[model samples]
Target chain A: MHEYSVVRSLLRQVQEIARSNGGGAIETIRLAIGEFSGVECTLVELAFRDLAPEKIGRQAKLEIQNIPLEAKCENCQQNIIITNYQFCCPRCNSQQVRITAGDELTIIDIELREVGVNA
Target chain B: MNQTITVNRDLKADLKEQANRFRQRMSDQGTLVVNLVSSPGAGKTSLLQRTATKIGDEYRLAVLVGDLATDRDAERLKPYVPVQQLTTGGACHLEIPLVESGYERLNQSDLDILFIENVGNLVCPASHDLGEYLRVTLLSVTEGDDKPGKYPKMFRTSQAMVITKSDLLPYVPFDVSSAVEDARRIQPELDFLTTSSQTLAGVDEWCEFLVRQLRKIQK
Candidate 1:
């Protein structure tokens, strides 16, 4: 559903980057999809594969990096890993916490072919 | 030759930079921007209508309403204050670029507060930054109390969490304290208020809170 829209925006960014950097055909685009980013990576990849080829990144490959959830505890002042959507502090059992990472979506890298050069 | 490369590191950093730039530019003119985020039917437009009605004349208020289609919300708020309907054209969130362009289109000489009602989706809008000084997210009582846990990013990113449609509390089984507590679990200092446009319950206090935020930015 919303994954399609995410793909569209991702492709738009890729296209802009490819065009601006001397009109090179995109080879691979690396993206990081955080666990809580609310974007489904599988659906995003599917849509990107379906759509990017029609645009400037025809031969482009998509590399997705999975980001895990990380949180900090309020009571123990300790860092705990949220493995299974369990946000409470492991030691203190305090629900007061903060999500330090794992909710992100961005184009971290783009593999671009040199203009007028073939590989 | 095809070689792989990495680009941006921190998406939130980039977004924060863009937002700060916008804030600096607007600060020079003493204008405060409020970015409103919520799910569909969460009473965002209704809240805007109430705010406009209550405090439109006090400040030079203008709104940029975002939606996938139709300027109906803009039209509804137009009579009260200046409004621009930005059709995202199927995009679920309003990015900095679009908001920048929308601000240009507004072309106002002096605006005390500019409210941008983002596309009615909690998931996407929570991730995108629109360069507003204040980010207020609303969760209606009718939508249940688990929204804070279900959509943690919205509550995490927003400066204030507004629980809308409190008048329906008697009919619905939503627990207000549970929702508030859930939101606080995500962000300890997150400010929130509950209100219903129908009963005028806490509407005045909500409006006052918004005004206080604007005034803080002005000072």
Candidate 2:
């Protein structure tokens, strides 16, 4: 799956950040993966486990947040919560609308063990 | 003591930061980045070969080809100018950081056009932002006309659509006009182009359009 590539980028970014922060080793990587982002969490975890250790983030723990899709109806301007990809107006059944949220894959922050502070 | 918790937030801020940095870098270097999306066997490589031959010397062109494995595309594109094949290593899509790195690897030169051939998938590739000036999605004549309507995101996100393998149009059931019309219904400003690598039909127009966009970025 594409999860392997996503993890590779995730690992690269996390390691860069960690390396930038005085070359400290990273212990955690937090990711916000939205439901509509089309990425499965279990697969991401599996990818991280397989790929992360080979890079600069050899011992990092992965943290993933699943975001739900949200959209607003164009006709009635109703804010509707969605679990899937369809963005339809509940009031008028209008398909003309925009996605408000839920499609995101990013590393928000990382936990690190300060250099020379730990064995 | 240890505890468990949930961290949640949409990456609005993160994406914004990435976008800002990307826009600044692209604008500073006058780089016209085009992310080419399509299904496997949609003739993206063939189209690139034709395009590079048409306008290779006139512009500072480079390509970042993505695939599950191999440097074959890069090797093929070498004689033209510069080509970097990014092996996704079993990944389906290219992300922003990788593109940024690819830019650096290209020596941050004054590129008139940078073609990023994304992994051949019509769905998820449309969702991720690769920081392109224009997004072009391709559908070959053999892939059926219903693809535009079926995968609305790819059509909606792209600024243009290319129907490749037009040489086979006579034998195929593809209705080029209807497919273009369908894409326009979903995205009003989406431009459509058709080409056949074998016959070299419509290839000039495609190169001209790309050259025009690259020139616009330069100005």
Q: Pick the candidate with the highest DockQ.
A: 1
Chain A TM-score (model 1): 0.92
Q: On residues B99-214, what C-alpha lDDT tens digit does candidate 1 reach at each position?
A: 88888899995999999999999888877778788889999999999888788767877889899999899999999999988888775678989989888788899989988888
Whole-model Cα lDDT of every candidate shown, in order:
0.83, 0.79
Query: Total clashing residue pairs per candidate?
Result: 1, 1
In angstroms, how far off is A102's CA in candidate 1? 1.8
Alpha-carbon deviation at B62 in model 2, angstroms: 1.2
Give every collision pair in model 2.
A2-B92
TM-score of each: 0.85, 0.72
Q: What is candidate 2's lDDT per residue for A64-94, written digit by digit as tens?
A: 8777777787788988875334445667777
Best candidate (score: lDDT): 1
Instruction: For candidate 1, list the clashing residue pairs, or say none.
Output: A108-B7
Interface RMSD, every prediction, one decimal place: 3.3, 5.6
What TM value does the first chain of each candidate achieve?
A: 0.92, 0.88
lDDT of 1 by residue, A1-119 (tens): 46876777677777777777777888888888888787788998889878878875467888899989888887788987786465678898887877777887777998889888976
